[model samples]
Target chain A: MNNFDVTVIGGGPAGLAAAIKACDEGARVLLIEREERLGGMLKQCIHDGFGLSRFGERLAGPEYVERFMDKLSEKTVDVRLLTFVTRIEKTAEGFCVVTVSRDGLERISTKTIVLATGCRERTAKQVFIHGTRPAGVFTAGTAQHFTNRLGVMPTKKCVILGSGDIGLIMARRLTLEGAKVLGVYEINPTPSGLTRNIHQCLHDYDIPLYLSHTVTRVFGADRLEAVEICEVDESYKPIESTKVRVDCDALIVSVGLIPENELAESVGVELDSHTKGPVCDCQLMTSVDGIFSCGNALHVNDLVDFVSASGELAGLSAAHYAKKAQCKVNIKIGNEFLYLVPQQLDLNADNSRVTFYFRSKAVREKSLLRLTVDGQEVFKRVYPFLRPPEMQQLVLNMDKFAVQNGSDVRFSIEVAE
Target chain B: MKSFNCIGCPKGCLLCVEEENGEFTVTGNTCENGKRFAISEMTEPKRTICSTVKTVFEDAPVLPVKVSSDIPKDRIFDVMREINAVLLDKRIDRGDTVIENVLGLGVDVISTSDILNRK
Candidate 1:
């Protein structure tokens, strides 16, 4: 049996960040990762566009993770690679984390816990694509990990479904690996990925992007031989005569990503159906006291940088909880948005500046993002464009709107289109 | 009728162009960018080629590389031939300039994938 002041699960950006923050607060933290390496998905993501705020430098995923890992080593933080935590049970005092590694089954007790299991890619089975059971089909992330990370292309002639970030990234990846990408089909009229990715990956490669289109059927008995694509109406229903057949050996699907919250659910934490993550206030804590969560495990983040930032909040909260800290007030979500973090309010807590993370329902062009409390607008900003691909983060100083008038302070983002 | 689709955006606007005896006419576009797109698609097809060449880099057997120019769609094979013929020496790090001013297209092929040292 092992024990620590703080215990963090899943050694991705969130876990690593939380562990580092806890250690920074002079807390003995036990960090566990199920993977053989410290870096999580960041390891396989060899692309840049990470670490703009945290490091003030744009870096690839691995490089961003290396920074925190180096700090963790300097702080002498204990991390167990390939250590899997199977169960977490809350006791009268704190919680017990049961884990199993190559050594054997082990249990650890901690004052506070943070879950950062991250997310997994949505597959063909989840989306229900009409296709034959073929060998050449794969998820875009799986294919990327295989070829880009493992040096093995899944197939030669490929047709990608979903113009998601992963799908777009793989279109460029597979094309470079001596494979012919027939086309990328998206059911939506607009791509579900970042704009820059579409230009740099698909347009640059001349890989046809069929928007408002979908793969109606997948042909081939044993291996993927071809695909039938058809255009869809505004209602997302397929048009009859718009069918086009493309011969391809493989099909890659990047439908979307969903948070891994089996552990979160097992702990009886309240989940938001929109984000498919835990519903909390602004502190990033879960419904269960002393148990916090962040990263893709909380919500599927479009950027790794945001995930790290979110993790920092979870880490800070965990440290405070270990020391038995409390906050007098809590901020709740308002409207046109889903939810906030840190479900409880601590009146005695001194942290004034608060960062609110949220997501929008649809894409908005040229709108004002406003924050209000009890029908009074406190903070507002105008933007040219707002996208769901990018999570919206707003930093508000409670000192700016600190008041004794309202007992319930609601903080939600409203679009003034 | 000059009804062409703008492959520029996911919107995929169906632009119509009417040429009365070699003159120019256009319609069916939502934005001005789509206007430029229709003119270009009807006149010439353009695309940017992003692919990696042979690399002697350390860790990564394959490095991410992209073309510098939006080459004419027909010149894809030609540009690819030029790219395939070259050998990129090892020690090329991520974001390193692999090929500069490729094909006078004012674009340079860059390394997007990282190669790490074993030590």
Candidate 2:
């Protein structure tokens, strides 16, 4: 039986960071990756504008991840490439992770486990694009993989169904590859991607963006030949009279990404409905003892920098984890937020320098984010503007608030008059 | 007055540029980079492009490359033509220039990864 201090799943940027940090903490760490390479999605993300916050330089995704891969090479973390985790069983000591590889099934025991499985793109069917199963339909990430990694063009002409970041980037990428991107149709009134992405990717290429519009149906049998695009009303119901047929070979969807948390859920970890991920504490520890969730498995993050940051924190916490009773308290949020990560705080653990990631429910010109504890205002910060697409990060010293087991920690954003 | 979204950073500040007698006045920039970006947008818009070049390696079909600096945005397709024409037969490390002074723009297309060499 193989035994380790920590086991980090999914060899993406987050997993690599976790394994490296855990190794640096002098803990025996094992990194499991389903793919042969370690870069994960970064391998397919050939675009730049990554690592602007972490490395302070706008680097290509591969370059950004390679920096961590370089650091990982120097560490003694045990890496298992082309290994898939099948099951995780809780034990008295810690956990027994069952995995399958070319060698066959094997079980490894670890004191603590870090979930960094990342997120999966919502497919066309998931977004309710009614049609016969076609070959040309692809998620934005899949299109990116085919184009950037395999050097294969997924479509000659395409209509992107979402304004998400990946969709916006692919619009530019496919255009650069001599493909004709007709237009990007977004269901929401406002663009779902970052302001920078909209400017750099779509606006730069002169690709038309139709807001409050969505693809309702596909009209093809073998390969996608056309799609029915229609405008939506306030409740997001498609307006039947506004249906317009757009001729295109492919339909690339970038509706949204959902965190890959099935493994965590299988381990009996409580999930937050808002994040669609594990309900985590300030240290990124999940409800399950000796188990921690980070990166996309904790919450879908807008930036890769924040994903790596959460992975590092989870790795550090896992490396130093010990079996102890936790005094956890929920951190409530008002309806103004789209979602917030680190849904709770373990009062028993160190509460200083707690990082919280959140997004606004809608666009706000001027607002103030207030933090209240036990009916008393503890912290507040004013913002010039807030948007759902752009996530915000705040690191606060929760120790100063004197948060106890029953402390009422509430977060709300108030629009400025 | 011409309005532009300064892509200097992710903040995407709405920059309003005014020109009078070949002199530009830019506002709504949070940093000096934003101001410089606005001026460049007004004069000659330049952008850094990252893409892949064909490689002979079976394990890695394409190698990612990016301009050493920003190039004229209008000449992007021209540069892409130059990039797509290359069939890299030699194994190069990261930061190795795939093309020097690409299309006489004074920007070299450099490999962003050493995946080929690693394999």
Candidate 3:
């Protein structure tokens, strides 16, 4: 049995950042990761577009995580690798987190917890495509893990579905590995991945992209032989006669990412119906007091930079709540945008500054993302573009609004251009 | 007018280009960037090259590699030669400079995939 002031779960980018921050704030922290390695999914991602904003230099995912891992080594944070957290329960004292590692089953008690379980890929089982059972079907992430990290090519001729960032990246990765990528299929009329990724990964590779289309049926009983792709209407129903059959050996799906919140649910944390993660206040505390959540486990993030930044807040919040730091003012979600973090704000909240990360329902061009409190706009910016696929981050100084000390503050986005 | 699809974006804009004398007028694009993109496609096209080459390493069969820059559409075969000639040891790691300043294009060939130690 082990006890700590703070228990950080899932040692991915979020958990690592939170643990490091908590330790820096003079709190004893425990970081537990399920994988044998400490870096989490970032370890498998070999692309270099990461760390543009967080580190200022464009680096591969491993390099970006190496920085955090190095920081952890320098801090007092304790890390446990290959540890699976089975359940989390609240007690009269605080929270009890149960896990099993190489040593055996273990229990830890902490006053505050941070859930960073990350997310999982949506697979064919979840999509439920009507087809004969065949081999060579893989989630884009899984195939990427195999080919990019493990040096194994999953297949030769392939058709990728979902046009996700991972799928787009895999299309390029597979192509580089001597695999024939017929095309990428997306149900949405536009790409669900970042614009730069679409341009660089698929467009650059001459891999065709079929928008508003998806695979309706799979062929081949033993190994994937071919797939039937068709265009769909607005409601996602396939239009008749639009089916196009393409010969392929494999199908990689990158449909979407779902937050892995089973443990959170076991602990009875309130969930945001929209984000599908635990409902967290500005402090990153979940519905259950002192049980915080961040990273992809909180919400699927488009960029890892946002995940690290959000985890920093979760760490500081856990530290402050443990010490019962004083502050006032609560921030709330306003119109158009999905939800804002720190559900509550502190007027005295380190007036240094606060950055809000959010997403829109649809693509908006030449717009203004505005931050407001009680229907009055406090901050507004001319954002040339915004997309549901891309997260929009807005930073504002709490000092600007600390004077008002308004009880009900809200944040939202609107077009001003 | 001849209709050719401009593979500019996922939108796949169908371009209407009419050539009179020696100049071309292109239209049917959603953005101004698309308009310029269509003209460039009709004139000279370049595509990003992504392909693996033989390596000297045996820890794994091959080390996944890629051209550091977009290759001229016509020079793809030529680029493949340069990529094929090089043989890297199993020690090749991701983002490592596989071919320094490849083809004098100021871009280095790099490993796109991480090659882990075979345990």
- Maximum-DockQ candidate: 2
Model 3, chain A: how large is the TM-score? 0.92
Estimate, for each residue in A1-417, the C-alpha lDDT of model 2 and write its tens digit: 399999999899899999999999999999999999999899888889889889899999999999999899889899999999999999988999999999999999999999999999988888877878878999999999899888889999999999999999999999999999999999999999988889999999999999999999999889999999999999999999999999999999999999999999898999999889999999898999989998888888888999999999999999999988889999999999989989999989998899999999999989999999998999999999999988899999999998888889999999876
Off by over 4 Å in 1: A323-335, A338-348, A399-417, B1-119
Q: Rank the candidates by TM-score, best first.
A: 2, 3, 1
Task: Report lDDT (Cα) of residue A53, candidate 1.
Answer: 63
Rank candidates by DockQ, best first: 2, 3, 1
**Top candidate (TM-score):** 2
Docking class of 1: incorrect
* Model 3, span B8-88: residue lDDT tens: 443445678777886878887777757776666667766555445455565444454556765556766566678767666
Per-candidate TM-score against the hidden true structure: 0.78, 0.99, 0.81
Candidate 2: pairs in clash:
none
Candidate 3 lDDT over residue span A1-417, tens digit each:
377888999888999999999998888899999887777898767666677677666466766786788789889888888988998877877888888988998888888998888999989888857789899899998998787555578989999999889999899878765789999999989889877687668866799999999999999989999999999999888997898899999999999999889999988887776688887655677777788898999999887888998788889888767444545565656556665554556443465566666777778876776666667777777866667887766666766663465555766667774
Q: Candidate 3: which stretches are off by over 4 Å?
A: A323-335, A338-352, A368-372, A398-408, A415-417, B1-119
Task: Kindly indicate the candidate among 1 and 3 with the higher DockQ.
Answer: 3
Which scores better on TM-score, 1 or 2?
Answer: 2
Worst 10 residues of 2 chain A by lDDT: A125-134
Give lDDT tens digits, candidate 1, residues A1-417.
Answer: 377778989898888998998889888898999987777887766655578666765455666787777778888578888888899898766888998989999878888888888999998887656868988889998888777566567989999999989899889867756799998999998888877687657876789998999888889899988988889999999898999888999989999988889888898988877778887546677777787888988888777777887788888878877445545454556455544444434544543766666666567776776656566887778865666665666776765565443356765445565
Which of the two, 1 or 3, has more TM-score? 3
